[model samples]
Target: MKNDFDWKPLALVPALAILVFPFINSGSTWLTLTVAGLAMGMIIFIIASGLTLVFGLMDVLNFGHGVFIALGAFVATSVLGAMGDWTGSDQLWRNMLAVLPAMFVAMLVAGAVGLAFERFIVRPVYGQHLKQILITMGGMIIGEEMIKVIWGPAQIPLPLPTAMRGSILIGEAAIEKYRVIAVVVGLLVFGLLAWTLGRTKIGLLIRAGVQDREMVESLGYRIRRLFVGVFVAGSALAGLGGVMWGLFQQNVIPQMGAQVNVLIFIVIIIGGLGSTGGALIGALLVGLMANYTGFLAPKAALFSNIALMVAILLWRPSGVDPVTSR
Candidate 1:
C-alpha cells in the first residue's frame, strides 16, 4: 500500500496550511478567528475526552453523552442565576464563585445519571452492537424530551461574571477573558487526565482491560466496577464541558447538545476511536480549519471542516490509528 499510494505527502498538506494561514490573514480578524477556533476546540475537547474513554474502554457508542453536557450547562446557569438574585450585585465574583459549586454539583448529578444508565440500560447490551445502538438512541430521545420538559424548550442566558465579560489585550490583539479562562481550564483538564491515565495504577488496569477485557477479568480484576468507574467519570467530564461552555457562551438551550453531536462524532472519527491524544489533535485541527476558512470564505466557513474530514477519510480510513503493516 505504501508503494501504491504515498500517504506522507498528503499528511503534510494540513500542517503546511496551518503554518501558512497566519501569513495569509494577518490582522485583528485573524486573531479573533484563531481565538474563536481555539475556544471552540477546547469545548470540543472537553466533550470528546469523555467520549473517547467510553469508546476506547467500554466499546460503547453513547448517544446520551450530549444530554449530560446540556444538563450541566442548565444546572450551572440556574444556580448562578439564583445566586445573582440573592446577592443583588450581579457582579463577576458572585457569578464566578456561584458557578464553581454549581459545576461540581452538575458533575455529581451527571455521574449518578450515568450510573443509572449503565445499570438499567447498558448492562444487558454488552457485546451486542445492535442492541446497544437501539438502547442508546432511545436514551438520547428520552434525554432530549426530558430536557425540553424541564427547560421549556427555550434558550436560557447564563450570567457571565463581570470579570469574564471583558477582553484582555495581548500585544496587538485582544482576547476574550472568558475564552482565555476556558482554554486554561480545558488544558488543565487535559493535563490532569493525561497524568491520571499515564501515571496511576488504576490507569494501568484500565489500559490493560481495554486491550484484553476477558484476560483482565480472568486475572481477578472486577471489570464491572472498572466499567462503572469509567462511565461515571466520562459523564462527569461531559458535564464539566457543558458547564464551561455555558459560562463562556452565556447561553443554554435544550437542543444545544443535539446540535453539536454530529461535530463531536466527526472529531472522534478524525481523532481515531479510543485515543485521547488524537481527539485533542483532531479537535484543534477542526477548530482552526473552521476559523481560518471564515477568512477565505465567510459564508462557507463550515465547508472547510467537511472538506478536511473527507480528505482525512479518503487518505486514512482508520483515522489517526497508528497501526500499519506493509
Candidate 2:
C-alpha cells in the first residue's frame, strides 16, 4: 500500500472557498453562504455515502437508494409529529431528545427495508451492471409509490424543532441555528466514518475483501455477510441523511429523494465513485458552487454543478481520485 498522503485534493475545499470569497463581496453574505453551502454538502455526503459503499464493496449499482432517503424523511415526520411537545419545546436539549430518536427510528426502518431490498431487488442482478441499473431504478419507482401510499401523495410539513429555528449572529453575519447544527453533525459523521473505515478490524477486513474477496473468504471470514452488513449500513446512513434533508427543507414528499438523486450522483462521480473522502470534497464543492452561483447568477444555478462536473472531469477524467487507481 502506498503510505504517502496526497494533500492536493484535500486543499480544494479551502481553495475554492478562498477563490469565491471576493465574488461574494460582503463579509456577512460570504460567511452566511459558506455555512449554508457546507451544511448542504454534508447532507449530500451522508446520502451518497451508502450508495458509494455498496458500489465500492459489493459492486452493486443501487439506483433505488433514494427510496431509503424518502422513507427516512417520511418516518421522521411521523416520529416528530408524535413528539410534538418535545419538538415544540423552546429548549434545544428537549428538541434534540425528539430529533435523535426520530433519526434512530428512521435508520432502523431504512435498514430493515434495505435488507429486503438487497434480497429481493439486488441479489439476482449481481455482477450485471446494466440489469442492476434498470432493475434498481424500477425498484425506486415502486418504492416511491409505496411512500405515497404510506404518507399520502401530498407534501407534509416537517418543521424544525422550536429551538432549531432561526439564526445566531456571528459578528454581522446571521447563520441559521439548524445550519450550524448541520455542519457539526456532518463533521461528526465524516470523522466517525474516517475512523471506522481506517482504524478498525472490520474496516481492514472490508478493504481486504474488496481487494481480494476470495482470499478473505478462504481465511474463514464470511465475505457475503460483510457485504450484506455494508448494504444495510449504507441504507441506514441514507435514512439518517433523509431525516436531515427533510428538516433542511422543512418538508417531506415522496419524490424528494428522487429529486436529490441527481446531486448525489454528481457528488460521488466527482469524488471518484466509492471514495468517501472524495465524496466529501465533491459534495462541498457542489454545495459551494450551487450557493455561490445561485447568489450571483440565479439563472445559471441549475446548470452550475453540471458545469463544475464537466470542469472537474476535463481536469481528471477518471474523477478526482478513483479507487481503482488508488
Off by over 4 Å in 1: 1-24, 85-95, 321-326
Error of 2 at 195 (Å): 1.4
lDDT of 2 by residue, 58-163 (tens): 7888889999999999999999999999999999999999999999999999999999999999999999999999999999999999998878999999999999
Candidate 2: Cα lDDT at 249:
95
Which ranges in model 2 have alpha carbons more than 4 Å from their true place? Answer: 2-7
Best by lDDT: 2
lDDT of each: 0.75, 0.89
The candidate maximizing TM-score is 2
TM-score of predicted model 2? 0.96
Expressed as tens digits, the lDDT of each residue in 1-326 for candidate 1 is 11122244334435735674666656665676677777878888888888877877788888777888888887787677677653344476665677678889889888888888888888888878888888987887788789888877888888677656778887767888878777777788878877777678787677666666788899999988998999999888888888887776678888777767777888888777766666776677777777677777778777777777788778778666421321
- The C-alpha RMSD of each candidate to the native structure, in angstroms, is 4.9, 1.6
Give me the overall lDDT of model 2: 0.89
